[model samples]
Target: MSAPDTNTETQHPAHKTPLAGIAIGVGVAVALLIALMVWLAYNGNEPRDASDGAAAVQIETPTGGSLTITGTASD
Candidate 1:
């Protein structure tokens, strides 16, 4: 006489998909974009060179005064 079956049956594939490549690509792109934005923001926020000081701001005094710009670049 034969014994009853005890093994289980599976309907789907056993191995799961690994989309690490796509994830890595997206991460790299995001990092690059963030770095670029940071670079642009830093450059935009500060003056071009040590010679150029703070940005020119419009000001109207009680009797109107001439603007004198100065730069104190330590390093």
Candidate 2:
């Protein structure tokens, strides 16, 4: 009896994974987050000057006690 011939050609092509694209996207996101964090860190530590037009409020309670608060109006 004769042996059957085996097929040497592939039926389907191999599909490539988008590893490089995913890596680049992750890198960009991380860089943007780091930059935002750095910007916030620098801006948040700035000192507020008293000459910057700060406002104060005082409230008198029914028992003749007073509450004093001071800061900018936006605070």
Candidate 3:
């Protein structure tokens, strides 16, 4: 017989590369990104409410000695 052809058709199935590795790498990256976004959403909600209802002054009141009380109230 003459020399056989050496084209792509002569390649073996065992020599072929797999597509599974590329798909798994992409799937893992997407899962991590979604988890990080959820954490940031819960963190920003609390500080906004605390700043709106803050107090500037505290007072001390004494009992029936109701004879003397001195202070100025301001708004």
Instruction: Provide the overall lDDT of each model, using Cα atoms, as 2-decimal numbers.
Output: 0.63, 0.74, 0.56
- Scored against the true structure, residue 67 in model 1 reaches a CA lDDT of 62
Model 2 lDDT at residue 51: 66
Q: Quick one: how many clashes does candidate 2 have?
A: 0
Q: Between prediction 1 and prediction 2, which has the larger lDDT? A: 2
* Model 3: per-residue Cα lDDT at residue 9: 62
Model 2: residues with Cα > 4 Å off, grouped in runs = 1-17, 45-75
Q: TM-scores of all models?
A: 0.39, 0.43, 0.38
| Per-residue lDDT of model 1, residues 1-75, tens digit only | 764763435412332234566788899999999999999987785566445554444556678875654535442
**Weakest lDDT window of 10 consecutive positions for candidate 2:** 8-17
Candidate 3 per-residue lDDT, tens place, 31-73, comes to 8788888888767544343344542343555753424333333
TM-score of 2: 0.43
Instruction: Name the top TM-score candidate.
Output: 2
